[model samples]
Target: MAFALRSLLLLCGISGLLTGVWSDLKVVRVPSCPKGWSRLDDRCFLVVDKLQTFADAESSCQGLGANLASIRSAVEDEVVSALIARFASTGYVWIGYNDINVEGTFEWTDGSPSVFEDFDGAPPTNPGEDCVQTYPETLSTWDDVDCDTPSPFVCAKDLH
Candidate 1:
């Protein structure tokens, strides 16, 4: 009898947890993009009015109170793609991931590479290509490109 009671209690607890999670997810709406920016996963990225080099893009993100944004989930990636499509910039957008630490080894400026791994679907394996960017030319997710090539970047920060 005791074992059966425990099992029933466990089931109820699990059900409650699932219910709460569902409610939370439902309440979570996509964040709004700021003017001249795109919104994804509650974060906004700048839409360059004029084409700028990668460095310039990074600077722009900084100007907006965030660093170069990185997409770490399918949801965020989709948002980025949607924004990119809408804006239709010529090329890739700079993300926080890069191989600046070691050749062919990508890491985020945030210090933890794994934190940004979700956004990094397939990383670079080539020796020369170190930095990461979602190349506009291909829809294969992320592509390793030369760091100095210069492209637009995404920036992220705390909601509060």
Candidate 2:
């Protein structure tokens, strides 16, 4: 009888935990993004209107402890595109993707995996045009341009 009673109490305790009837736990707040930056998921994004070469733009982002924005999924692509449309000047904006190391093999400046591509038409057919940009007017589709070309850019950093 005692064993059965203990089992019943244990079951009730576990049931209370699963049902969230115990209110001893404290709530943890999510970290906030920097001022003027937009928060999405676990990242913070900022579109800079200043025109700079791809390398220079990346350097500027590094100064802020961020990397050039890397779009890893279609959802991220849309969010970044919206950020550009809202905050950046009307033109192509530099992204972190580039084939600067080897033609036809694109990689993100932040060393993220090249998992998604949103090209406007063709997928980077122009050799020596290594840097990647998104044309906000064309559904925010991507294009490869000369790395030396000056353009606005997006920067991304972790919320932490």
Candidate 3:
């Protein structure tokens, strides 16, 4: 009886191990972003070399099947800032935050709630400044600028 029980337990263990390995093998690998784009945290980002107005930048990104990059966390901000630092001619780059819908409340282009903000000097105090850009002096911080200001921008797309 003891020998049978031991054999049954071993068989169960082997079966479980095989099942785990099979599941792992079935997992699909995610492809990397296309050339000239960087992959970070399941998102692909591309920095536009040419400068454009905030609205124009957004439109350009849409044409590429992406939207203006949105920074939702400090780590994401750091990643984007590094990318911009490498490619951006101007210190600042346009992001996806804007207060066009409501004067004081900023929202991401994707319509998601704004949970993170890294304002450089002060928050967007002026009413006319509706668009947001990275502060070149402090790459990690942000500043609200006029939507018509021309600047290079980052475009982001999900990898999923």
Number of the top candidate by TM-score? 2
RMSD of each: 12.3, 7.3, 6.2
Q: Which sequence of candidate numbers ranks them by lDDT, best first?
A: 2, 3, 1
lDDT, model 1, position 65? 78
**Cα shift from native, residue 77, model 2 (Å):** 0.9
- Candidate 1 per-residue lDDT, tens place, 1-160, comes to 9999999999999999999998887455645656676555456665553555556666776777776666666676666666666665665676667776677666665453454453345565767666667754566268767767766666665343
As for lDDT, the candidate ahead, 1 or 2, is 2
lDDT scores in order: 0.64, 0.90, 0.87
lDDT of 3 by residue, 1-160 (tens): 9999999999999999999998888667878897899998788999997989999999999998889988878888888888888998888999999988888788888665688889864567678899999864575778888899999999998886
Q: What does candidate 2's lDDT look like per residue over 51-158, in tens digits?
A: 999999999999999999999889888999898888887668999999998898889999998788998655776887999999877887898999999999999988
The estimated TM-scores of all candidates read 0.63, 0.81, 0.79
Instruction: Give the runs in model 3 whose Cα sits over 4 Å from its true position.
Output: 1-27
**Pairs in steric clash, model 2:** none
Candidate 2 stretches with Cα past 4 Å from truth are 1-27
